[model samples]
Target: MRITDLLKQDTAILDLQAQGKEAVIDELIAKLNEGGRLADSQAFREAIMLRESHSTTGLGDGVAIPRCS
Candidate 1:
């Protein structure tokens, strides 16, 4: 599915205060719960974490693309 399709309204944090990977992950999880997309959220987060463990998804321009498996 498209990234936008998986992103729920609550998942869009226009102004996030947390800084760091862990905080970001927590925020994402919270958003997923708020959006009522637990299944999709868990799958997506897991994929991101796995990929991050192998290599950074950071594209070097301050952008990261986390996808769902």
Candidate 2:
């Protein structure tokens, strides 16, 4: 599947209220959970946080792509 395929109206946030990276991740996880995308939100959050602990996910210019499998 493509990124566009995964990013749907239900999962997309137009005006994000999250402040920092951690908050953003939490918000996104919640969004995915509400959209019925994530099977286990806590597990997914833990995996993402583990990946983040190894290194930064911030790309640059106030952008980040946090991911885990």
Candidate 3:
């Protein structure tokens, strides 16, 4: 799906100040929660962590795809 379809001004944290991986995830989740994209942040966070445990999202292109199932 197009990111523009889901991403909006409210959900985009252009000035993220998170200092670490988990922290960044938390910050993004908070943004999504604030934007009404998630009904349960903790549960989603757990899922993302579970997925991360399988393998790193880093693609060696300075980008990471954080996903949860």
Please give, for residues 1-69, the per-residue lDDT of candidate 1 as tens digits: 667765666678888777798677768677767887676666667777887788776777656765434
RMSD of each: 2.5, 1.6, 2.0
Model 2 has a clash total of 0
Model 3, CA-based lDDT: 0.82
The reply for model 1, stretches above 4 Å from the true place, is 40-46
Q: How close is candidate 1 to the true structure, as a TM-score?
A: 0.69
lDDT for each candidate structure: 0.70, 0.88, 0.82
Question: TM per model?
Answer: 0.69, 0.86, 0.82
Cα-based lDDT at residue 24, candidate 2:
96
In order of lDDT, best first, we have 2, 3, 1
Better-scoring candidate (lDDT), 1 or 3: 3
Which is the leading candidate under TM-score? 2
Q: Candidate 2 on 1-69: residue-level lDDT in tens?
A: 356755899998888899988999999999989999888999999999999999988999978878874
Q: Clashing residue pairs, candidate 1?
A: none
Q: Name the runs in model 3 displaced over 4 angstroms.
A: 1-5
